[model samples]
Target: MSNTKDIPFSPPWQISDLGKPDEPKVTELAAGPAVARFAKMPIVIAEDDLVSRTLMNSLMEKWGFKAVVTKDGHEAMAALRAEQGPALTILDWMMPEMDGLQVCRRIRESGKMVYVIMLTSLGAKENIVEGLHAGADDYLIKPFDKNELLARIQVGLRILELHAALSARVKELEKAVGQIDDLKLRIPL
Candidate 1:
C-alpha cells in the first residue's frame, strides 16, 4: 500500500491515470522569497506539443513567472522580437515554420542578448553540440525533471542578471571616458 501523505497534492487533471508508480511528483519548485524576486518576469515558451506546452505554462505560473506561451517557432520569434520582450526563452527542437536551431541562429545574428534554452528529445552528443553551437545558452531533454528545469531557469536568470550588470558598467565606463575627454579638451596640452 502506498503512503498517501508521501505523495504531493496535484489537481486530478494533472495526475495521469496511467502514470508510472515511480514517477516523481512535481513539488514546489521555488522558495517563496526566491519566487518573489523573479515574480512576473516574462518567459517565452515555444512548444508544439499541446500537453507539454500546457504543463510548462502551469509550471511557470506556479513558480511566479509570466509565461508567454507559443505553439510554433515563428510565434516564438515574434514574441521575442516585440518591444520589452522577455530575455529568457525555452524552445523546442522541432516545430513548423522554423526550428529551434534556426530561431537560435536568428536571435544570435540579430545581436540580441537573449538566453535560449533548447528543450527537446534530441539527447545525442552531436545534437547537444549542435544546439550549443547554434547559440543556445542551455539544453534540456524532454521528460525533464521539474527540479532540474527550475535549476536551469535559475541559472539562466543569474546569467541574464550578470549580463545586465556588465552592460550597465560598460556604459558607465564609457561615460567616464567621455567626461575625461571633455576635461582633456579644456586643459592646455
Candidate 2:
C-alpha cells in the first residue's frame, strides 16, 4: 500500500514524466517578399503601435537589414538627421506632435535625398495622391501584408537609386562647364 502523502514530485524538465501537453512557442513571421532580403541598408520605421513596431523590426532583422523604430514623426526626423551614411524612412501617416506628411515635406526641404515611404490607414486615392505630393516615394495602407510592404519599399529604393544617379550626372556636367569656363579665361576672353 502506498501512502497518499508520500508521493514523490517529478521535475518539470523531465520530458518523459510530463502529464499536460506543452504549449507551442510563438514564432515571428518573416517578410513575405524576396526583395526584402536584398536590402543591406538601414531603415527607420515610425509607427506608434507597439505590436506593429515589433513586427516591422523583426521582419527587417530577418531580412538582414538594420532598423530603427520610433513612436512618432518627430522622433523619426531626429533619427534621420543624426544618422550617418545612407538610410531610408517609413513614416506613419498620422502621429502625435508631427504627421508623416509634414515630416516628408521637411525632409525634402532639407535637400537631403533620403528615401521615404509613408504608411497610413488612409487608402483613398486622394489620400495617396496627397502623400505623393508631400514627397513620399511610396504609400502603404494599414493592415498591409509583409509582402506588400516589402514591395513598396523596393520601389522607394529604386527611385532613390535613380535620383542619386541623376544627381551625380548633373554634378559631372556642372564640373565640365566650370572647366570650360577656366579654359575660356586662358584664351584671353
RMSD of each: 13.1, 20.2
Q: How does each model score on lDDT?
A: 0.78, 0.72
lDDT assessment of candidate 2: 0.72
lDDT of 2 by residue, 146-179 (tens): 7777667667666655565566667777999999
Off by over 4 Å in 1: 1-27, 32-35, 83-86
Residue-wise lDDT of candidate 1 within 1-189, one digit each (tens)? 865332232211222442332432224743323334444456899999999999999998877667899999899989888736237899999998899999999999988778899999999999999999999999999889988888888788767666765676677779999999999999988
lDDT of 1: 0.78
* Per-model TM-score versus the true fold: 0.82, 0.74
Residue 37, candidate 1: alpha-carbon lDDT: 47
TM-score, model 2 to reference: 0.74
